[model samples]
Target chain A: MSALLAIEGLRAGYGETEVLRGLDLVVNAGEIVTVLGSNGVGKSTLNRTLSGVLRARAGAIRFDGAPIERESCAAIVACGLIHVPEGRRVFPNLSVRENLDLGSYARGKPRRAQNRERVFSIFPRLRERASQYAGTLSGGEQQMLAIGRGLMAEPKLLILDEPSLGLSPLLVEELFGLIKRIHADGVSVLLVEQNVVQSLEVADRAYILAEGQFAMSGPAGQIAADPELKRTYLGL
Target chain B: MLSPVILIPVLLNGLMTGAVYALIALGLTLIYGVLHIINFAHGAMLTAAMFACYFAFKTLGIDPYLSLFVLAPVFFALGYVLQRFVIGPASHGEDRNMLLVTLGLAVVIENALLVNFRGDTRTIDVPYAFATINLGFTFLAVPRLVGFVAVFVVAIALWLIMSLTDTGRAIRAVAKEKLGAQLQGIDVPHIYAVTFGLGTACVAIAACLLMPSYYVNPGAGNAFVLVAFTIVVLGGMGSVPGALIGGLTIGVVESLCSLFLGDSLGQVGIFLIFIAVLLVRPQGLFGAKA
Candidate 1:
């Protein structure tokens, strides 16, 4: 299948400090491609670069057949390449429903009402607290709202940055299940995470990033079963 | 001893003054709330609008009330351009720098007006400027009453727009979280410009309304701007309704002080109340705790 997102020689960083150096990555259509990394491995940086929040210093990023390296963040979102950023950056002052409503501000505005219903159905808890401020939600619920908001954009490629972070084990399992279900519905997901075992279980293809480079890449099963990767990286 | 005969007119006059203060302070508070910068040049903007309204009246033979239709959109566009070119760039820099820039703009505008219009006080003498309406108990100046009613109308209209519209929601969202709003595809810069324009529009309305009763001069804005700042702080820095309440309260206090104490000490009375309020409720009446 043709790639839904393709990046080559991707280099991005903060002032005077390089984080992502000469990286190449791809996510094909209708697949959950997991990018696994530990702390300070530049996974979040890659997500920022892809979402156009951080400008790529040197790279070519083709998303759904258009070069998006120079695209503004809003333009990238208009292309249905939605990024549910790290830390559940939900508008704390806004009600849950308002946050979801804003997800379609750039794209899918015409079907905002219908998409809101779809999001509420997927996240029944959001519907329950629809009128409550997003800041009042518990951590797990906030995470759900973030993903629900991403879904509101009708994302063709949803880039989730560390969705499993700070969730309880039960919630983590539930989140993985939710990802799998979302993927099954014909949406491509670029899952950037630290939860190796759970991420590997659901992702069709996986890449382990270390020191700003893809240290390993293959089918999910192969990466999970590789004894060397297990002993060294996964610590299984 | 307070006579009801003497007190009634003082109270009404206080309210009328408060209405004008509230109108001006509303713009200041709104700009401060969203931009996170107290626009010191707000007074200058008001002064500029006063000049614009005056010229429209003098040159085009437009009534001050009718001139609003032209002045409002013109001021709004000017505000957008100012934010896009001047304020937007300085916004990303230090807050102190933004403050200095606005202060400089104020000086520049005030001096420019002085250079052109000179120091003479100019007032638009409409036919009804000195006319009064008998309210049974006491007579109210027709111009003041019109301005008083117009203030409430503008305030209510602004409240509805902020609460009911999609654009308002985007604006509020941007104020709450810029990055989150951007992720949702809100153009932050565009919103900022619109908000700045809205703030300037409020000033335009105030300028038009004031032209009926008040005189316009280069320093006219300076006189009101200080009172507007006090009202904003009293009401809660960013609260629209707060500005109204604050303005009224200050107006009543000023009137009462002028009645009992003296006209010169009226401001002293306002300062005393302001300091007392700050001591008790630093966030102002409506401001949420930071």
Candidate 2:
């Protein structure tokens, strides 16, 4: 399969403290690749660097075969690389509909109406609360709204950062199902998640990040069966 | 005396002045909504627009009313450039640094105006300046009524832009959530510049409306900005309609207080009520409760 995104020698951090150190990764077209890490193994930093919110000190990032390491966040988004950030940061003061509308602000302009309807279909709860301020939504609804927003861009790849961060197990199940549904529709996913078991269950492949770099990488089934991963990360 | 004849005119006069106050406050409120900074340069920008208006009439033969066509777009461009190049970069996205940058710009702008205009108050000789609408109770100056009508028109236009346009939607999104806006591919800095430009355009419009009815000097704009700041807090820091209603309410209060108390004491009376409201509601009338 052709790769949709490729990263090499990626390094990033905040003010003299390195967080993501010399990591290399790839997400193939139409693939679900989950990156699993505990609380502070630069999972967020990796997502931020990929999305261009955090600059990489030394790395080469190519999206759709074009260098995008130096691109601005807007340009990166316009290239159809959408990131649904952690914590479901919806515009609290804006209505759910407005949030969806802005999702097409940079890309998918002509298809905004159609894309919004698609989002609503995928997350019907969002449609029910269409006019409600996003801030007032329950946690599950906000995450759904956020993912729905990312879909509005007609993204080539969707980067989900900890989509299950604050959801109940049932909601997380629903979210994973939604992610599978979204993937079934032809968009690649780079799922950065902490719920390793569920992640491995949904992912075609998995990467375990520890100490600023991936310690294990392979097919999802193989990584899931690894004894060290079971003892250290899975606590099985 | 609280006679109808006296009371009626005071109310009318207050409403007229309130229009100008509302215009100024609208600009301040918009900037605060987006940048979350008080924009210390706001008053100075108004002064600059006033001086520009004065020169357009004095040096060029453009009437103050006609100058609206020129000043608004020019000041909008000026504000855009200021925020895009100067404020955005110099502050490094820190609110406190933005405050200092705007404060420093205000000082520079005011001093520049002072050096050029030199403390001399200036007014133009438009024939409409002396004309009045003679109500049976009292006669109101034509310029003041024009200011009232013009402000409503501007406010309505602004409201339309905010509610009906894509840029406006993007702006509101940015105001409420900067990161979410960025994630959606909205250029946050561009939106910031656009908001500042829109705010400055409002100031330019207010300057145009104020010139025929009022005077211009380096310090004259400060008199209005202090009140605009009060209106912003009273209206709520980021609400457009809030600024409008808050400004009018403050205007009527100021007028009534001055009527009962002497001019200096009236200023005290306004503040006393402002404190009372803060102590009671905390959030202004239109502001959402924090």
Candidate topping lDDT: 2
Clash number for every model? 0, 0
**Local lDDT at B153 for model 2:** 96
lDDT by residue (tens digit), candidate 1, B82-134: 88778778767454566777888889989999999999888887888899998
Tens-digit lDDT track for model 1 on A102-204?
A: 8988899899999999888878899999999998999999999999999889999999999999999999999998988888877899999999888999999
Over the stretch A105-124, how does candidate 2's per-residue lDDT look in tens digits?
Answer: 88998998999999989999
Q: Give the Å shift of residue B114 in candidate 2.
A: 1.5
- Residue A68 error for model 1, in Å? 0.8
How does chain A of every candidate compare to the true chain A by TM-score?
Answer: 0.97, 0.98
**Local distance difference test, each candidate:** 0.88, 0.91
